[model samples]
Target: MKLPLQALDPDLFARAQALLDDEWLAHDADLAPVLPTVLARGVGQDWHKAGTFRHHLIGVARSLALWQQPRAVRLLGLLHSVYGNAFVDLVKFDMATERGRLQALVGQGEEELVYLFCTASRREFTQKVLAGQIEPDGSLPLHTNQGEPITLAPDVVAAFLVVSMADTIEQWFSWQDDIYSRFPDTDTSRQQKVHWMASLWPGPMRPSGRMLHQINRLGLALQHPKLKGRLPMPPVFEACTAPFSASDDAAAASLYWSVIQQDQPLADLDVATGVLEQAVRLNPWVGEPQMVLAQLYLSAGRREDAARAAESALQAFCSWGNAWDKRVQWDAWIAWTRILLQGATTDGPGAWPERLDKLNNVALRAGA
Candidate 1:
């Protein structure tokens, strides 16, 4: 029995296989000819989540697909993630520790080109870290000790931006759909997602705007021939995005600042609270409004209010993560939170805060 050729990447191969289920791997068929080019045309036909530090390689391929890459510079669009995962360590700023099989598939020029992509991707993460917008703790952290901030040429920035946008559009579904499938109808899972969102971020300045843009962009892309298979989403997504119009986001954003921002005061606490309530109703699933309101209470030095808000944030945290390069930052944040909590509560078995010896003695006596 002859097996059909397939792209090396497990995911691509699996998807290709599913697309041609009528044929078997043991018997080569029409899909045979399609597989080789699929593996050859792009970054190669494979990817590894752990090996590939970030989505930069995918971004690079996206750039190539959009004709952003010059002829000499482009080799395989599919080989995007091969470098970081197998050739280099984008996060560690080092060559990959393991060079098992992929080393032979891609040579020096191809590898060097991939390195350029990695460097460019690192620059993006670097800017975010320097701005204190993203925390560095993932496989995709700051790349090098470049004495100081590295300035990129304008063209590179444009290239990076295009790749970044395309990468995110692909990831929103690629990454999250996996989560949805795993925990389809779990309340606890949904609440955890909501909690995560609340704890992190300053809160949504424009939920409706974000959703509207995402939905519209996705719809537009689906109409294109290249993105045909990847375009459509579950019908429920429409219901999810029903209220994310520009007008709705603008109104919610206006209502939010009315209550939260010190620079702008439009009403009393009650009125501000009312605006938030309306905003929340406008987009209940989003975590930002709840967070902002909670933060507002805390800013006024309201301890209970702060706790309540923090609790809400925790409950709403999304476990699946997103493509805006947000997960690494949050993973860092959660680690800090764990350390702070342990230190604060470790006063020798006290009720939050008490004499260490006394608290220990009380516990000892209770046991007796």
Candidate 2:
């Protein structure tokens, strides 16, 4: 089967395939090693948005990886806001003093991109893209901190937009909206919350507002008459812009978040299962609802249903981004899905030990 980014970035797509073939997250060790042990202390502790800074960072990097972005863009996503920006005020690295330290870690080129990403006005960049304001030479006009004007080269614009898209998708969630909203407690209704967040952004960027804005920008770029050969259209661009309705994501997120918040969520298995079933149908691209449904099915001894759900969950994680749950990496969720698959696939209690050995082998060779 032709994967999402197979044509645009064959090597990265192959890396993705290597990961799925081995059933482990280790295949992308090339990207993971850039964030060394020295920098981990700060990023691992700071709180950002709805989760820890480390989780958000890795999630953005993984999102870029899923989109089959080039290594530099992926690295930029990983360390995008370490120096802080307009949206978030948590700075893990000092701009003036720590630039050299970060450059030593991720190299000068990537560090520069990260600095640009952190210092530039992402809101302005987003607004320009939405307004179709790209210059004929593909230059993007932006302003850095304190409104210093800067125009990005065409090549730099492409890289910046990709990292920006990944960053927006990785962190923009209803939970994120609630975190930054004044009336978070007051807006209890699902539709109300979605509408409230949607109003904060531009156009029909509703249900999944931030991501939809990115999609809109990409769509305009793809169709732009002047950008025909100048702007490169990524392979995952098609998949990301696939036919997913606004209400689908809205309802799915509402249901998924509500259920997971309960005191003893799985205690009422029937209700939980039904809710997840609807959620999975509404937004099949997300894996958590399907993953949880598989768990519920397994507990109910519905082996066939459990196995099917687990497989679907794996497919979803492999195909697209999943920022529904920020606490865990996409690979960790894939491992959980495989474990559930093993439980649902095994014949009896004796088969458990044999499957366990296979799982270990897969994990060990995932990077190979």
Candidate 3:
């Protein structure tokens, strides 16, 4: 599940809606009209008007409850998928999926933002989990070959677990209901088959299972506000063995921090190549590792390595998208730009002047 509140099991939507109504939403006419557009495909073949705003509402509302002020969550949840969906094709991914392409066209920072709320919502979802709130899971696999547990706050985890359940209820099960109910007692009826085919092979969703999930969550939260936040916390496993070593807050932090703070901390994208090498060894896919390594190389006056690292960091950030911590991705691009500028100032290497021009141009565009 992508968000914790999505799994509230009962009345999730009603409670979330009620809380929102009483708190921030407060019957804002300006926002209500836009709800249908966010779910414009207009439902599935079931004639259920499936993908109405209410479905996504439950998932987003529950997830945001952890950290988002009611108003902000209302806005973020409502707008999260406003641009692109089965029904709404407001944004396009025609843009390249790599940093070089985006940076060339839009410059660094703007490119990062473009990818953030656009297609990178996955990243934004995870950021909540990292901040100790319950949030959703993502395809961004922890390359910790050992699958180590990353500690997060309980309430945040609850929110994420719920969101994940809602995703299953609204996005998955509701999308293909018959397949789940197929008793498959030998041959199936053509009508049933066509009914299933028409259900999804054509377009968007049906709101069957989603409503139940919302109702279930709301009921649970209202009844047991205290127990509503309970979720089993799994321990970080040794990546190589999947063996658990029960970790408290301090131990996990110490181990993670040791590698990060080693050979000199990678403070705001200013680390040496040696430092980056260690970081990449420990956490290779991390965006900052590559960015800082690039910065470190540029500082030591190594042009080729610096360029390569810049490319890696940019590509990493872009592919991951902004859905999960869009701000951090922007910071990566800015940091790269700063390094490029520094190189040009020092007469560093090939096409330094061209790089400088592009850097300034992107900065101007991004208001950097």
Candidate 4:
């Protein structure tokens, strides 16, 4: 069982409370009626070996409030995990039988947001929104478990991003606590969360510049020395300036690669590789698919294939106008891969470490 908030270290509790207060939530009266019930149900529940589930929910809500999101959005953050969303499933509340009560407490609009969030299919959302599949007017059509398509308005998408950021930030903070020691699989989860945020940053539904700055600050905070090795770093590359126009083959390749990253069965590795080959064939000019293929090859210990894919990435990066500004990032990747290949091939003086240090210095200087 977790200690009560009051029992936490005074300074730590104070710092956490200060962070929460920064979100400027609505007056307590608005949340008063529902607070007790939420706390009661979440009391003994653990949130991924972090603090209590109630605490995580509160942190998310506070984060949304900090982002100055609308009341409905804040409430949605508070209730996001109650019905088992894509990333987490701490279902202390049943949505089906308790809709009216929840709606009555949070208002119809807020309740609807919670319902949509809880029922969204994570895979489809990633395929459509994160992969840049949008309607001409910039709306993303998300499918629920029932196979019904719901086109999200731009404002709703913005709210969703805010809530998602809050949830992810809270999780990252939890990873800093000793209770949630890093595990082998933790990096995959961290990567997916950061990738979602990075991909959405360049979308039409992006948050305000100020909000984006705040999100970046939170990301940087996770890089504190103590937490640096425990969590996956956010992508160093800037988001694509234009929306992706991936062919079906490319999209399928991305989907397969996503599955592989999530620790899917070994059988999926061959399928992912084949799909990536098809992607490269369908769109030889796109650097992203080729880069992903390189990573896949590297993971399989095929250094020669990895080197070939890295060369292709450089070629595609040079020819792809959308990647013009990302040359520094691509250069860093190429250099890193070369060092790996060199280390594998030579038993001479270990200059690779020095080269790697220089590479890191260059990356830091380049603000990557």
Task: Go through the candidates in order and give each one's C-alpha lDDT.
Answer: 0.36, 0.63, 0.37, 0.49
What are the per-residue Cα lDDT tens digits for candidate 4 across 1-368? Answer: 21011111234223333443423333455555667777777544664423467656776765454344566776887788777765665776788798888888889888888888888764465445443454555455888867888877655555555465566544432122112222212244345354554433222221121222223333343333333333223221122111223244235434434543553456546767766666566444335556666666666766666656655564443322112112223234434434443433334442223342553432211211
Question: Which residue runs does candidate 4 get wrong by more than 4 Å?
Answer: 1-27, 173-368
Better of 2 and 4 by lDDT: 2
Q: Which stretches of candidate 3 lie over 4 Å from their true place?
A: 1-271, 323-368
With a 3 Å backbone cut-off (N, CA, C), the pairs that clash in candidate 4 are 23-65, 23-66
TM-scores of all predicted structures = 0.31, 0.66, 0.28, 0.43
* Candidate 1 backbone overlaps, count: 30
Best by TM-score: 2
**Please, what's the RMSD in Å of model 2?**
8.1
Residue clash pairs of candidate 2: none
Candidate 4's displacement at residue 287, Å, is 32
Question: Which run of 10 residues does model 3 get worst, by summed lDDT?
Answer: 1-10
Query: Looking at model 4, which ten-residue stretch has the lowest summed lDDT?
Result: 1-10
Best model per lDDT: 2
Native-to-model Cα distance after best TM-score fit, residue 329 in candidate 2, in Å = 4.8
Model 1 agreement with the true structure over 184-225: per-residue lDDT tens digits: 132335564655654333333222233323433323322233
Off by over 4 Å in 2: 1-34, 37-41, 92-94, 97-108, 131-137, 181-238, 258-274, 296-305, 320-323, 327-332, 350-368
